[model samples]
Target: MTLADPAQITPLAKAPAQAAPGAKQRDVRLDFFRGIAMFIILFAHTPGNFFTSWIPARWGFSDATEIFVFCSGMASAIAFGRAYDTAGWRLGTARVSFRVWQVYWAHIGLFFAVATLLAAIDMTGAYDKVYIGTLNLWKFFVDPGPQLVGLLTLTYVPNYFDILPMYMVVLAMMPLIMALSRVHLGLVAVFIVGVWVFAQRRLLAEFGLADLHLGLPAEPWSDRKWFFNPFGWQLIFFSGFAFMRGWLPKPPVTPMLIGLALALVLINVPLSNIGVREFGFDWARDWRIANTIWITKSDFGLLRYVHFLALAYLCWVAAGDKGVRLLATGTGLLARIWQQALAIILKVGQQSLAVFIVSMFTARVSGFVMDNIGRDTWTVVGVNLAGMCVLVLTAYCAGWYKSQPWRKKVAQ
Candidate 1:
């Protein structure tokens, strides 16, 4: 099914005005999904190493780069599309541009904040390994020799895990992305494949190339420098955008995607345990079922894309069902709070940059405090949970503040 242009998409415009008079009735599910994605991101990035043993080979959901990136893209499409409908591309572009700046500045602020905090830790002579991670910040500006040329190009630098830089690149290409999203989803698919292929060979390792490795790093500072590379990661982003654009109409709750995901896991598990020593193709070592279906939590793998797509379909079906909606509404205070908090969710989500920075700092603080006390599994989980709660609460409160008409008037 061919989707109409953003200017033509009318579901949002056609929404009943009683509950949300001016703005469209916000998609509660998007906010819920984003909240879930943020939790995954927090879990993946926090270094207490809770899931290290259980997940074994696969990095924990904390490394859920694909889910986060895909959600980001989908949110962008929905957001900008709504703006385009109400206003025009000029207005929409301006709004999005401001949002980009918001994210960029938030990233910059967090960098300095982390740097100062780390320097303090270093001066105090604490956590030497963590301190070592701090020293790599120079790579962001200087591009430390050959190990980081990918950082300069914003590609596949190994250690950087932030997605801000990658989002910036994607945002720069947004107009083109939106345009192509309309008439050429197939081309987008091909482009993603090409980038993924090039990434494996490190072809984009150069300064001007795709630079797929820039954000694959595990350290804190260098990880910030490379972040995630949009070049290789764009497939996941665009795939989400394509879904929102209605390019590939999602078939609801189908067995195909789920079955494919399972098959991938089944095939890759045995191969993974055998190790490269057993398999003649050393390349098979990285060939997990997740990779087959885009299960990559860290990078833009193939299995993750499939899994996320499948999940989206499932969510859509569930939410569209009357019984599901009734159940959600009946689920008591927490569910009701989340439902009424749609405005809050969108506000914090829009300010994702701030939320991320604050959350990271909260995590760091938790880590610092907890490290002084203990390093057990419960400690790690507690620290992470505390940070996550603080972040969410702060975001929700900020959103509530923003939603106040008095505050809006004052700002205006």
Candidate 2:
């Protein structure tokens, strides 16, 4: 069931300040969900070995990324709304701009660092054969050609794994979207849909046009990348942002949400089986529809979108009641540890981009080691799970450290 928007649920008079300058309690639901998302993402990307192979279905959690992205949009809306409500548009714009810059710089720095490290490894002959990182500047400049043309046009061109560039574009558009949101959400939805259509064909390809390639790669066998095309994915993001504004109907917590959850799950099994056989589990494939849709990650196809929406409804149902919280509070040390781990996961999620980039680097290194060093599945799982735990702990500890009085004073 859909809960009313915070704006509708709690009147303006009761709305808390947007991240007030104090030890403010966070929205437990959001944090908890983010924590859950991180875990799913981690498991999804975990080494494709025996440990991960036991997974009931490889695609069961396929919509994890979509849900995370939607939530990220909603989270941004909450932050921006609070900032606008309190400090006005100027402050809100500045804050978002800063955050966008922070993400951009982090990505750029990550690219260069990785590139340099890979170059070093290549020179040193660290492995049987060294692999170069794909973050080469030559891809974007100097030897720039047809591939770079996509980047130049900002239409469906990005390094398959790099989302920072598209994210920057989203940030740039946020102001216009926020303004439009105030006037009419229907207009915003139509505008997003129109962009999605334009992305399908080569025409309307212009500098700064919304790219259908959401930083995922196009494969020879499968052209779609990670399926986060701005042309198509923007609808998901915009829908979540609009939801925060109370533009969509809130599903009731009673029968509607419960029923939807069950129905979607049931529909997904057969749909997924048919999709796998017909579409080869590729999200971007054209299953042929009344209206054309780009199903690739770059095109944000119907399959992934529907999967995401269905999973989101399920997650909402799971989150609607306090059962999970009660479970967390169970009388068991293991439960307590899991709860604490969840807290750490939330901290990592808050600083998600940084954590994600680092995790990617770690995963790459681990992959190399696994391939070259040895095939110790149990050891790999043990080590990797431990590493994940350490990463979460480090994130939370760093956040805790940042919150210390001396550090706060020094920043001031």
Candidate 3:
């Protein structure tokens, strides 16, 4: 049955007064996909795990990063967009600002937490591994003053802490983008693309500003650049936002379109495979790197964008109403199992911010384990599964906290 229709029958009763239409109901599809992406991201981030080789990035240009960020933008649009629509621009701006602050502080907290953990490990001197390589802990010890200042200013982000800073930048710009989109969506699109093009050309780096140096004794503290440039990545984010907002036209699903998308996927499958190149197709590797599209992850290259869009399109076509129905109200044994699985995933997705923060810590710990201990197949699998369970538990706790009686009473 579709969303509009109920599969189960109910007793008829006197009609009640219709409630006024308000904001759109939450879309579980987004949450479900995002939750899956979270799992993929956790697996992908676990350093030295053989599983990383099997993540989507190995077979395609876009990976969990693209999905996570794009979904974040879509979720942001749902939240901030509704705020802008119901309240005034000022309220929406305030909301965005609040989120930016939260993300900024979260990034800082995560940075310190990871650094302290790695520093503790380093002090033991039992691992015989470089902590600086993983956590950038050396700078924190040598130049705490400047490093702290830079961290506060978002000028010096460690490796894993980079994404949140980029997210903060995007959130900061949401108010302006929302305003422009209201006036002219095409204008907003043009501006997003323009910034992306500028980033891809490395204009900021060309001007010697990409690595903004702070006056610090340590090399890491002195020079910094975001791994994922917000300027270029914003295009992907806004594309998701625009699509969610119905500001962009959807392509009609047709045989030709499906064929083209399939062809794109097939092409990328080989191109992304290093083994294919090692086994006598060395020219394919050279051509892909030197290709016009560039396919670089740092700048969110055109091919990456196209690859994500294509994958999304194919998923949409393949799933359609049946998928929605299954998630909504399917009841066979397998369907029931899937529904239960989706519930766990949905919880994780709903508490995504909390889950993401916890996942990063888990990833670091997992990395340490892999680096210091065994990395055999079973060990890797066990660690990954345990980490995922921790993430899911984090989500459950977050959800439970949100649903506390006192919290509800206070809100009421």
Candidate 4:
């Protein structure tokens, strides 16, 4: 059921530097799972989508955030690691900086775009909910002077808008981590673990250890900090990066490992949100409350990390080596349908950054539509479906543009 020798796994680093024939093949497993996560993000972020309650978060300790961050780490390894390998350290860091710059502006642009939509919709005076107040962006709208600077400098990250800023900071940390990788991998491990521990200042504070938690200030005038802590989250991101960069060996799929992963996933269900609400697991609820920091989303809790890895390993096995299983569809009408669906999913995953931005934009629109039509069964279903269509369209559009179709000759 498994390869007994871990030595058979050739790391990306240990292997010869030359590119193998057809080495450009993208990992279908990564894109497919990321695409699934993208859909969950849309549902989770929608203001009043009751369907979101049924998502993985209700059934487990970890949710789509772990998937997104972890996949992003893998993606960065393929992208920036190549830059460092072929382009050398200086140019690679420059590439990282360029990406950071792009993401920075994207953060700024997304905030204003969402803000404008909220303002415009609110101005109509047609909706029951005050959109601005719903997100508590009135603070920014009422007095934009200092907060404008704070937003630009990433000092005033609102909770909903915090993910991009968190991503930007982690991307910025890549150069330092990459530099450490060159000196010695053990040094890199120590540095990563040390930063992760430092980020757990909130956990330390619970034990009365009086430490400063890791985060940027959420607002210039408030004690609140950024909802997502980059220092803590970078661990997952870099873990994926390390795996792809061959710093970590590929985990062999074994029957025992598979059984343990399934067990871990199932056990979490009893402690999950659905479990507490439906099964009336008061004890489980109490336990979670007692160990909030270990499961908290903000600090990238340990239980979540374990759960995600377990879940990830299972999915990895299911996807089959190199995700070849995902590509397989036997001869049937159902197979044909899966083939098309797979194409769409891969497209969405390939254009994640663009698709994610559009998904966020559409989530607000989805909420507005749901509010107007009311959240009946068919209406909710229709709204969700419509939002998904928009995301698919966004994906294809982004891909088309990225392909530089304009450069192709019209005719010979």
Candidate 5:
């Protein structure tokens, strides 16, 4: 059931890609939000970046993870949905399978490259700290045999390396959801919801019940699970997916709805992790500790899901129709500057997968640089700005490669 009146609750609006009369139009909103998330993720991952304290997570229950997963779902709808519609389910399945393979290698490559970098840094004896130890990868180096096998099988997932694995699992669920739509859209909804419910085993167990026993093992020996549990995270992922696929209805932007969403966001500020720790609110801390399960990141707890939706709704409304408000139209210098800035953001979002891989590696290096130097006010700003520049270059280079200038016809 919808929260709004039936009249106001209609299928979600499609972005106006307008390649042809009936073709899907590109949604600037998705790219804008995803671009913003890329910057936030960079800040959040950087070891001593005080900028992270100002990121969304510090003031709210949800963070860049929500934007990433949710946007991935919407992007998948655009990137993969057409193949399923034009080709049969079998071909669509093949297409998605290829993507999963690509992502699998990317994840593996990221781990090895980063690990090797950290190891090399440690071998130099330049810094006092063991670089590799920061990531808690000692077990992998100590017992490579078992850990290698587990890594290949996705059983040795470390917290820092869990996002992609979780993303892969969520991506794997798309074809099944698509096929379910053929039988009945309602069936697809039920199946998606059922999986999410199963993922909430942890939350359910907290209420004096049996555990749900879901999620992949995060270690070779222990019973630890992946930090980002795809099963539970898929709830939000599929929420964005379904919204793009017209499986769910978008509520009309009403003043009452906006107020409700805004209030929820405000309420979360005082209840957030930073709020409790920084403000020294004993009562808030007590409340948060007792109800930690509700906001737990691993399980994609109910409060986070609710809070994210509220935040997302506010963002959606603020961005305006088709996010046209984000475009700078005037011919003035300021408009030109804003337009260029917007282009960079959109490019970064379009190349999110590549930018993400680079960001992950660069964030570590940025921290290491600061470690060698210092994390002073100016130093912190300088290091983060340097990292952002790398990300920007990565986005531009990725975009250029994707364009394949080599394939262009020779000019006379």
Candidate 6:
């Protein structure tokens, strides 16, 4: 079946009334998916957990990072886009700049926090070699001078700390992106795609432009490039932004398309499995080879892009007006439970920045626990459950803090 016309696409526009100027309406769908992504990310990041293997990454080319970044882009566009619409470009740009500052500091704070945690774990003799080697924390502490400089400059990032730096870069560019989007979304998309292609070919690396050293030593960390190259990842981010801005055509929900999407997901599951890796056909291997050009996670591969698109499409189809009504208004026990669960998730999602930061520390703590204690089934379950509870509590606290009358008074 054919898709609906782009011009006819509409937003849910179901956010509560704003008490202050420049406050954009909150979309529960964004919060719901973001919360889910946070949970998946926290689960997946905890090393040696059996549950990590069962995440969506095992079933598709994309993972929670894609969902997180895409949703973030949509959120940014909604927040800043509205600012620009009402308060003009100056305030919009200021808002973007302020957000960039916030994320930058958050990234710095997270790095130091994780480093301190690692240091504490090391002192306790619970330091896992895997974490140490992956994050290069040993090297970080050994030669703190240059590495610290690099970290401050966004030139050096350890594992688990890469996404925020990329996010900071993307936020820094939001003003330009918003400007181009206003002129024509097609122009913005083309520029983003061009940058992605350039990054994919390692053109920047070819020109010896991987990263800036800022007069620091190139030996340890100053010259190290970002793991999640912002250039390639920007395509996914901007695609989310564009879609949320109604720049892209929205397809009407149809049984045929939904069936096709489900079929694609089903087919991908086996193909993405370890079993398929063991018994790969020549055609499959060839397809894999072909897919490498544009599907690798390092460069935000094309297959990964397509997978997220399919997933987003599925979500769009499933979260229509009728579906939302059923979810919110149903009287059955399971329905009520789901509604309550979504409310909690929405709260977590609304405070995603704080929750995400807390999740990183929790993931590290959970990993440390698994490494020092045990990796048995029950142990894994207990550790994961504890980590999730902490995350939920963090979310609740953040939501409660934001809801306090003092906060409103302070804002006024």
Task: Report the Cα RMSD per candidate.
Answer: 7.6, 7.0, 6.5, 5.1, 5.6, 6.4
Residue 41, candidate 2: how far off, in angstroms? 3.9
RMSD of 4: 5.1
The residue-by-residue lDDT of candidate 3 on 1-412, one tens digit each, is 0000011111223212221111133456667777888888788777887888878888888888888888777677666666666667899788778777777778888887888787888888887687765655666688789778877887776667777877777778788898897688778978888778777644445576655421112134354457677877888888777766667656788999999998888788777854353355677778775763458776678899999888878876775642575365566898788878888987777777788888888898999887766898898889999999998999898777766769778889
lDDT of 4 by residue, 1-412 (tens): 0000111122354323733212223577878888888889999999889889899889999999988899888777766666677678899899888878877887898899999999999899876778988788988999999889998989988888988888888989989998898898898899888887778765879777645567677988878878888989888888887887778888989999999999999999999999999999999999999988788888788899999999999999998998999999788999999999999997788788887888888999999888888999899889999999999999899878876677775542
Cα lDDT for residue 380, model 5?
A: 95
- CA error at residue 204 for candidate 1, angstroms: 9.2
Pairs that collide in candidate 3 are none
By how many angstroms RMSD does model 3 differ from the true structure?
A: 6.5
lDDT by residue for model 6 (107-210), tens: 89988888887776567664437455556676777788887887787667775788887777777778887788668767887888877777674444556765
lDDT of 2 at 359: 60
Q: Which pairs clash inside model 6? A: 294-302
Report lDDT per candidate: 0.53, 0.54, 0.72, 0.82, 0.81, 0.71
Model 2: per-residue Cα lDDT at residue 151: 42
lDDT pick, better of 2 and 5 = 5
Clashes of 3: 0
Q: Which runs of model 2 end up more than 4 angstroms from their true locations?
A: 1-26, 39-57, 60-62, 133-160, 201-227, 270-294, 321-328, 407-412
The candidate scoring highest on TM-score is: 4
Cα lDDT tens digits, model 2, 223-315, are 544334455566677666555545565566677767766676665553343455544755522332322332345555655666667666766
**For residues 33-53, could you state the per-residue lDDT of candidate 1 as single tens digits?**
555555555554555646433
After superposition, the stretches of candidate 3 with alpha carbons farther than 4 Å from their true spots are 1-23, 202-224, 274-280, 321-332, 408-412
Q: Which scores better on lDDT, 2 or 3?
A: 3
| Candidate 5 C-alpha lDDT tens digits along 291-375 | 8778888878889999999999999999887787897499999999999999988878878888888889999999899998899
Pairs of residues clashing in candidate 5: 16-25, 17-24, 17-25, 17-26
